[model samples]
Target chain A: MENVLELKNLKRHYPIYGGVFRKQVASVQALDGIDLSIRRGECLGLVGESGCGKTTTGKAIIRLDDPTSGNILFYHKEKKDGVDIATMSPRQMKKQGIRSKLQMVFQDPTTSMDPRMLVKQIIAEPLREQGGLSSRALENRVVELLELVGLTKDHPMRYPHEFSGGQRQRIAVARAIATNPEFIILDEPTSALDVSVQAQILNLLHELQQRLQLTYLFVTHHLLVVKYISHRLAVMYLGKLVEIADTDDLFNKPLHPYTHALLSGIPIPDVQHKLKRIVLSGDVPSPLNPPSGCRFHTRCPFVIDQCKSEEPVLEEVESAHKVACHRKNEVRKLVYDQFG
Target chain B: MPKLIQAEDVVTNFYTYEGVVKALNKVGLVVDHGATFGLVGESGCGKSVMVRSMMRIVQEPGQIEGGKVVLFFNGDQQQEAVDLLQQSEAYMEDLRGNHISMIFQEPNAALNPIMSIGDQISESFLFHRKKEMSKKILEDLSADDCRVFLPLKKLQQTLYTIAADNPKSFILIICSKIPILSLWQRRLKREALQRSIDIIRKLSISNPSETVHRYPHNLSGGMKQRIVIAIALACHPMLLIADEATSNLDVTIQAQILELLKDLKKTEIASILLITHDLGIVAETCDRVGVMYAGNLCEVADVEKLFQNPQHPYTKALLESVPKFSQEGRLRSIDGAVPNLVSPPSGCRFHPRCSHAMEICKQTFPEEIEIEENHMVACHLYVK
Candidate 1:
């Protein structure tokens, strides 16, 4: 499969100031060296706890937040070479048509959209931003976009507050795809919705992806939803990718300790199924002063001396399965033995 | 199982500017002793309102129009059940945080930002356990040989004895009102703070002593939730109502909190009334489940039976709507939106969206029927 987007060691840091003089005391390394590739039309799920920088990575990819270092390569079929968009200004991105090819749907649809605007205007904002569409053309486009997102014809006249959470999310989706974005960053889009409504949105997203051939960077903490929607999964801990594999492979044969813990911790809806949950002991450490060596070493049950002293880079342990752990094999064997 | 709390024909309404929104319409359910009862519903389906009405904590513009919240505090089944709704505000105030306590959805909003975590937890002890704390202070004063000038110590002991006999004593009330004389109960406050530390430690919070001094903002989300649980559990209430207590936290933190609640249920709390929208958490934690829709009780059954053989169409649809990792298919979502409660459907609120709805379902609300052992469904299909 051809790759649509590639992140090369992307880093985003925010400086923390202190003292009377307000000197730069320290920095919060929100995105500390991440590498990822989203294949064309594939839903790549990013799962992590809050403050783990998954949202930051999504923002950086879409250029909503400026990256402190590294390259974001967007491959265009028309152009022979991949374009490095990490350092591009907003004006440059708009000039190069990168803005239209990338869009984002935020987590909270209620807050993301304008309450005063009608649904049609909300969806047509992006199209209007691109310019050149007459009133008749804009109206037709808005109706088409609404229908694509499963909204009724009359919904275009209603305000966002008049719609339910799920419907508002559909409008947000319609707006995101209005510019015909090839890659969309969905940051916890379904987290704020109820289960039944969440199913509707998820199905709509899946259908839209198929119909539009859109690649997605789905960032969420929901394990079950990610397992159901994404083709591949990436687990992040304290700003770095801890593991990446096919969704089924990661769920079935989790090598990284954090990934295993996260998978086991989910509450499965079935009554007959009982998971042998490896509940992690402590909370994720502060990103400002992440633990020395491996960030997860503080809470890892299989921590060793080497894991505390030396940082482990993400290495491919199996075919297409990558993990950043010093004792991945040992942890895997123990988990297998315990489950068996 | 002996009944712990039961809400019968509970009707709650919110009188908004637009109209009267019927939040809870004749909702009824029973939570047995030592069993976790889960109330699962959508956002405005009255799950929270039902519990709030039972606790008599419904905010302004909302009224619990009619209900009998019978609480069986005596686990041995000897004492008569108390109707919480019929009680005076003073009695209800005393009953809350003493026999039945509630944990809210947002820990940040639930906790006071200005107060230290220790002071917040100690407030529960100070409010409901006043007499006990007074007695404990008296005991401490008698046990200690150190003298604060012997006569002053004697006077302090006499004051604590009065506080122990009647917490709302006239002299103590006047003293509490005054600035300088309020120090008379310092020992009692200290005792409550000490008990706060013990309860925080019981929740397995690291550095309980240190955590007590910090504000709510300083602690992590999970730690703040644990503190909220500590405040709820400080008095060791007979019933603990956790309303979406873990919904706002991350999955890992949610797991930790759920595990802690499970352990606490086994050791501390007698019965848990967990209200949430997540069926998965209900399946994992609850012994029995109640499905609520548009202010009405749709179904009630054992957790396993409800999952395996759901009776109501809405319940079945809800179960099928949740995406399963082990299953693959296009999800069958319930068509149409949740009904508006300002003027809900005449009979069954779910009839409009229900696939198996009959003519009778639109005319009158179906009476709850026992389809099997401990399984109750209130659908017109089950009526026949």
Candidate 2:
């Protein structure tokens, strides 16, 4: 499988200001040297808690938020061209057709969609701005996009407030797909919705992906939703990717202790099969001053002397299974001994 | 067992600018003594409203139009059951925190902003125990002794009062930097503060002496929720209504809170009416689960039975909609969104989204049928 999007040593840091002179006091490393890849037509799930930089990673991929330093390579097979979107100028990138190849679906549908604009205008605005289509052609494309996302043609005339949460999200999806982008970044797309409606949206995304062959970078905190939609999964902590592997392999044989703890934290329906949940003490540390060595070592259960001093790099231990932990094999053995 | 809390034909509605949102439609549920009755549903399904209605805590624009909330008191000389809905507003106030209490979803927002954590927990104890304590303090006292104790009692009462009475006099006389009476007043206040600290420590909070002094903003999400739980359990109310108490928390914190509630249940024997959207939480904590859809209870069954064999199409759809790790890469979602509550779909509310929806299901509402012992489902497919 060819890589559609790749990140090499990505880092995004925001400098803090303080004192009477407004001098730089310190820096908050939001993304610390992340290396990841999303294949063509594949859904890559970025799972992490709040403030873990998963959303930042998605925004970096779509160029909505520029990374401090990294290489973001977007491979466009149709044109047989590769563009490093990280350094591309906004206007130059738009003219070079990079904007039309990638888009984003925000988490909250109500806030994301323009209240003053009608559904037709909201969906057509992207097409008008990016594709530069005529008014009539834009209207036609809006109708088609709405229909593709399971909305009626009449929906275009209505304002966003008139629709339910799920319907509003469908409108957001229509707007994201208006330009027929090859890749979409779904940032907690269904977190604001009910469970049943979440199911509907998940199904819609699945159906749309199958029909349009769309690739996705799905960012969410819910493990179940990630398990449902993702082909590959990446577990992130603080600001770095801890583990990345095939969805099934990651869930069944998680190499990192953080990954195991995250999976066990999820409450399973069957009470009979009780998980020996590793209740992590204390809150997630501030991103401003993350701990030394591994960022997750503060909350990690299998913390060791080496894990406290030496930073571990992501190394492939099995086929397509990569883990960034000093004791990945030891953690795997512990998981097997207890769970298996 | 006798019902601890019984809500009969509760109808709650919100008059929004758009329209009248039918939040709760003739909802009826019972919470037996020491039993945890789980109300499971998707968001906007009125599960929270139904549980909130029990405590009469539904906010403005939303009112309980018609309902009877009866609470049977087991620990009394008379063994009487009172109709909580029929009580006067003043009398209902006395019953609220002492007899029935509620813990909301967001703990930070639910707690008082200006008050210390100790004072908030002590308010419930003061409200219910003040008169009794006063009597106990005045017991075996002569008329002259009572007169002597009067000034001390008045001073104690003034010290405990939360209202800002006589701010000038209080500042000059009680809290002055080097006043003669300030030292004695400080000692008196310290004694009252210690009582509040003892109550907070009873909730198993770490370092209650230190925690009681700080405001809610300094606490973490789980610690804040624990404080809220502590406040709700302060009075040892007969029925505890947890309205999405753990929904905002992460899974690890949620499991710990659930375990805490379970332990509290065994010791206190307080009936819990848990309102939640996650079926997994219900399966772990609840003994009996009631699944709701569009303001209707679609199914009610034991947690084990409901998980093993869900009879209602809506319940089955909800269970199947949850992605399981065992079935990774093969999970299938339910087809359509939940119907609008204001103008819900006619006949069966879940028919539009149900997989086994029939022609009859779209036109006729199904009656609740007993599939087996203690299990009831409302679906046309299970009628025969």
- After TM-score superposition, what is the CA distance of residue A335 in candidate 2 from its true location, in Å? 4.3
Instruction: Give per-residue CA lDDT, model 1, range B1-384, as digits (tens).
Output: 989998899999999998999999899999999999999998889999999999999999999999798988775464688888999999999989988999999999999999999999999899999898888778778886755878889989889999999999899899988998788978887888899999999999998988899999999999999999999999999999999999999888999999999999999999999999988999999999999999999999999999999989999999999977586888888877788899999988899999998899899988999999999999889744
Worst 10 contiguous positions by lDDT, candidate 1 chain A: A331-340
lDDT of 2: 0.81
Cα interface RMSD of each candidate? 0.9, 1.9
* Candidate 1 local Cα displacement, residue A292, angstroms: 0.9
Task: List model 2 lDDT by residue over B1-384, tens digit each.
Answer: 667877887888898886888877777777777789999988878888887777777899998899888788873323587877777888877887787888989997998888888777767765665544333333423335555457665654454342123323444454446565354344334444576677667656779899988888888788889889888887778888899999888766776688788888988647888988887788878988999998888898888899998888778778877876575454456666666677778788888887787899889878777889889888888754
Query: How many pairs of residues collide in each model?
Result: 0, 0
What do the candidate models score in CA lDDT, each in turn? 0.92, 0.81
Could you tell me every candidate's TM-score relative to the true structure? 0.98, 0.89
What is the Å distance of residue B282 in model 1 from its true position? 0.7
Show where candidate 1 strays beyond 4 Å: A337-340, B75-79
